[model samples]
Target: MIALLSAPSNLGLRPPQRGSVPGVSKAPEALREAGLFRRLLDDGATDAGVVLAGRYIDDDDARAPGHVRNEEALVDHARRLADRLTSILDAGDAPLVIGGDCSLLLGIGVALARRGGAGLVHVDGHTDFRHPGNSDECASVAGEDLAAATGLHWPAIADIDGLAPYFAPQRAVHIGHRDDDEELEEVRGIIGLVVSAADAAVAASDDLAASVVETAGTGYWLQIDVDVLDPEVMPAVDSPDPGGLGVPELTELLRRLAPRAIGASVTVFDPDLDPDGRFARLLADVVVDALRTLGTAV
Candidate 1:
């Protein structure tokens, strides 16, 4: 069985404008309105409900080396979100987390860390490897989540509960990053493997899945940032760049890997960009088409 969990937190992102919040905070409900919740329920997924987030302070940008935007609120949300995921996992169900932003990985990291350990499969358009070590502009955790999840960031966000490096670098695999990703070399060197979207275009889908699954070991957590899709297909993300995958490619990859994952998170979909809600329906369709097989192996 699968458990649908919502973590509607936008604390990790910078504001769209000085006084406005990121509409990513409304993703869970947008997806719900698109009938994802109802469709998943009909497909045997249980609704675990929403994990509300803290206020998104536009001025919360903390570039003070060791601090991140929405420091306390982000930490608090991660812990509470972990509690919800832990409960779902404890019940022998695979969690399909609807996220507000990529920073929700912090909470998912906490959940996996507490229960022994697990590998990670990160699918995003960018490497998301900015950290205090490499750069001082590490204010938005949404842009630096992969680095923080691997314990490469400051102790404040990385070493939560004294369980740093939620997913070991050697056991983590990255796929679907763009060919022009700035941090490609660094992330590939640190993470177990990195498959560029260009590589996935030529290689077999199952082969890509095998590489990630083999390197990530078993019971890996799957992180899918929708920016991995072509901006023409999914321009409703916080960051949409060129050189991303198509819908068929994404669905094929998900079908091959999702059933093997212990849990999964979907992030970076902004309802504000999707005014007419067509993108929401498109996203929901893709998820159900490819990820209905989630938890089949577990």
Candidate 2:
């Protein structure tokens, strides 16, 4: 059975204006409004209930270690989220975590690590491996999630509950990154397989799925940041990259990939930019379709 978990945290996205409207934090409610949970339940999933995070506070302090904005809040939220995920796993129901941003990947990583380690399949537009020292915008935790998950960043976030390198370097696969940053090269050195967007676009779905499953080992978590879709179809993200996978392509990939995952997360979709809620509905349908595929796999 699959259960939906809502982790509405936007601490990772630090808006320049203090009181700017929340983006990713509104994703869970938006998706729910689009009938995501109902559709999943109708397709045979049980309601796992929502796990709400604390309110998001934008702290402009540059003095935080690693230049992480809302560092304390981020750490606290991650810890809380880890606990929630562990409980979900203990219940034996696959979790469909709806996220605030990519930073929630840290919490999910920690949860899997505590339960005896798991592989990570990161499907997104950016590598999300930037260190605070290298980034021009020094405060967004969203940009550093992969680094923290791999034990490359601050101990507070990386070594949650005294665990470090949540998943082994060899057990992680990053797919669909388009950025040409040095961090992508750095991640390539550590991650087992780095499938560029161009490579994934050309590769057969079965081949790509086989590679990701083989690299991720027996158990793994799948993370999908909606920005992986082309801007023409998914322009509601904070940073939309051009020339991304089409919705059909991503859906097919997920159908092949998700069946091997212990759980999955959908992140970085900002309903604020999607005024008509078209993207939300599209995202909801994709998730429901993936869940249906997963049901068949199990």
Candidate 3:
């Protein structure tokens, strides 16, 4: 059985109004209001071959008042969420977590790490490897999430009790980056941190199954960021950069990757960035694609 979960971030630390992003309105609310949620739920419920459960996590990072922005609070929340996911998995249901921010990956990673070593296939435009020191450069909460999982910003994620560094460098694989960087030092440091963006570009294509099997090797988790797509296709993100994978490319990639991994969870952020709600629908589609892919394998 597969479960569909929505970790909607519209409640916390996000711009409440629509039109916050250019040429778009109702993006954040759409996550809550649009038919996408119901559609995903329906797909799960009606798919006889697969049992699906649906729900939404009501808490947001800002629920703690200044906590959402704090790394430790985020980590604690991640741990709690991880516990929830573990419970679901223990009950014999696979959890598919939606998101308010990418920080949710910390929880997912922590849970997977507890089970044993788990590889990560991260597809995003930015490296998200910023240590606490790098926070001074880009202060966006979503920006430092992947770093926190690596124990980079200990203060933010240290609150989670007994949780250790989720995965080592070799266990992690990143794809999709086209933005040029002036921080050559940091860029050079991430040489091994990233896989071939060229490969990521075509990763969602027909051979995605083989690609995922090769990367997953033994066992793995999938982490996706919508910003990994071109802004033209995914402009609702707070930090949408130009020149990345297209929607079909990334969706196809997830379709290929899902079945090979031991477990999988996706982080869908910047729902507020999507105005027409097409982006949210698109996110749901990618998730469904993964589920369908898993179904085929099962």
Candidate 4:
């Protein structure tokens, strides 16, 4: 069965400069209020409850290494989160970890590493491979998740529990990234296949899913950052890049991808941006439908 795991974290987002709202931390509750868990339960899924971790504590250190915000809290949270995922997997349930932000990828990576490594299917609008040094004032850990997961960044974040490069470059496939020139250049230096948003637009969904599965080998972890969807449909993310996949396109891709995944995560849906709660409901439906496609639900 698939278990819904809430990871309510906002540590990865940069602190509000002033008078800015903080709401990603509340995604888990927001999604539940929108009946994500109930819908899954109606479809025959299990509720794993939430994984408690350190609360979001914004960092004030501008000179921190790699300019990574909330370094200490992030590290601690990753450790605890990894432990929780490990427990769920050990119990033989597929975990559907929700929200916090992309930085929670570190914990997922660590858990997979403990199980002798796994492939990663990264679906996002941005590549999320930016090295900390390359980022500006924001220096959000959410933006650097994929990079850190692949060991392209600091050891503390990348090498958690001495498992650096959680998934080898050859074992990962990054899809749907629409990044700028410099970011694309950096991504190119990485040792994995990057399928741009444009490429995904033209490629057949089955072919793309097959290619990703083949690349990831036997088992893989799927990460669906909602920003990967078009801003028109998913405007609840922290950074909504333009020109992303439509809801139907993303749903088709998930149907093709989720079966091969051992576990998966959904991130970056900010309830504050979705004041009317419409986007939250839409996202919940998409995810539930994907889980059903995975055969984890009735």
Model 2 residue 244 CA deviation (Å) reads: 0.9
RMSD values for the candidates in order, in angstroms, are 1.2, 1.8, 6.0, 2.3
For model 4, the superposed segments whose C-alpha errors exceed 4 Å read 19-21, 61-63, 132-138, 179-181, 295-298
Q: Model-by-model lDDT, in order?
A: 0.90, 0.82, 0.55, 0.81
Total backbone collisions for each predicted model: 0, 0, 5, 0
Off by over 4 Å in 1: 60-65
Query: Residues 199-278, candidate 1, lDDT per residue (tens digit)?
Result: 88678987888898789976899999999999999999988999999999998899889988998999989999999999
**TM per prediction:** 0.97, 0.94, 0.74, 0.93
List the lowest-lDDT window of 10 residues for candidate 2.
Answer: 289-298
lDDT of 2 by residue, 206-274 (tens): 999888878986468888988889899889998888978888888889989877788899998898888
Candidate that would win on TM-score: 1
lDDT of 3 by residue, 1-298 (tens): 5565545432213333322322112332354465544665666622112111122223343345434343445545566767776776566555555555566677776786777657677777777666556545433346665665655555556334555567655556667766463332463464334544555675436565455455445456667776787888777675677777777777767776666555555554554455466777776666566554342342
Instruction: Report the C-alpha lDDT of model 4 over 1-298, residue by residue, as the tens digit.
Output: 7888899888788765643445788899999999998998887778887865576555564446454767777888888888888998888788889887888998899999988999998888888877755765436768888888888787878898799988898887888777463487767667467888777877899898878877886468898899988798888988888788888888888988887788889998999888899998999889988766452421
Better of 2 and 3 by lDDT: 2
> Against the hidden true structure, what lDDT does model 4 obtain?
0.81
Question: Cα deviation of 20 in candidate 3 (Å)?
Answer: 10
Candidate 2 TM-score over all chains jointly: 0.94
